[model samples]
Target: MSIPLALQNEKFANCQESIKILYLVDDNFRCMCDDYNITKENVEFFKQKTEEDFQCRMEYETLSIELEEEILRYIAERTDQ
Candidate 1:
């Protein structure tokens, strides 16, 4: 898989890269579903997955700008906390 564009740009390295940092969340979704014997009717797993995929793609599309904005926002947010 390709990395975000903001990561590719050296100019925005300090600001963007720092904010673009995402910790890969451990999703045991498949294991959970199997363990629980989940049924589609009881869970909207597929829908949630589709939504996440779309959001990720959108993020990837505007990686540079979004990452820069996110980094700035994160820095500002840190001050408030």
Candidate 2:
């Protein structure tokens, strides 16, 4: 699971403080979406531009490995199922 270089520099984690990279990938290891905490307000503002099924919420803080892992797990679990 290699992350994008642009996303890599987009205010993500340092294995210590917090992780803010939201990597929304499809089944083929391709990123369907990517966003960071700093840009969440923008996401909310422009969310209506995207389609109905596609959604990325801002309820969760973007500074935790658990959140990243949870999203990965969700992708993995759903794809596997």
Candidate 3:
């Protein structure tokens, strides 16, 4: 299975196995991973744009962080069960 960009972070590097399991079995977690990847890509795209796009980049960055945290929380909750 392909690794999601969100799971490539040091914060989640150790949770690969758990992530794979949850990703396959949980729709919400899967959606969060997809959203995280998309937001991450948007952040990278805006990083190359003009200063006018700085705000947009920052917004995406913030959303990306939120999504990352939510994904982590979900994984933790699931794995603890």
Each candidate structure's TM-score, on Cα atoms with residue i matched to residue i, is 0.28, 0.21, 0.55
lDDT by candidate, in order shown = 0.56, 0.47, 0.85
Q: List where candidate 2 sits over 4 angstroms from the true fold.
A: 1-63
Q: Which lDDT tens digits does candidate 2 get at residues 3-79?
A: 54444543444521222223333433233323433365467567755643343333334445678988899999899
Q: How many clashing pairs in candidate 3?
A: 0
Ranking by lDDT: 3, 1, 2
lDDT string for model 3 (1-81, tens) is 575866788888788889989888899998899898899888877776756578788999999999999999999999974
RMSD of each: 23.5, 23.2, 24.4
Return whichever of 1 and 2 wins on TM-score. 1
The TM-score leader among the candidates is 3
Instruction: State how far residue 14 of model 1 sits from its true place (Å).
Output: 61
Segments of candidate 3 deviating more than 4 angstroms: 51-81
How well does candidate 2 score on lDDT at residue 62? 42
Instruction: Give the range where candidate 3 is weakest over 10 consecutive residues by summed lDDT.
Output: 44-53
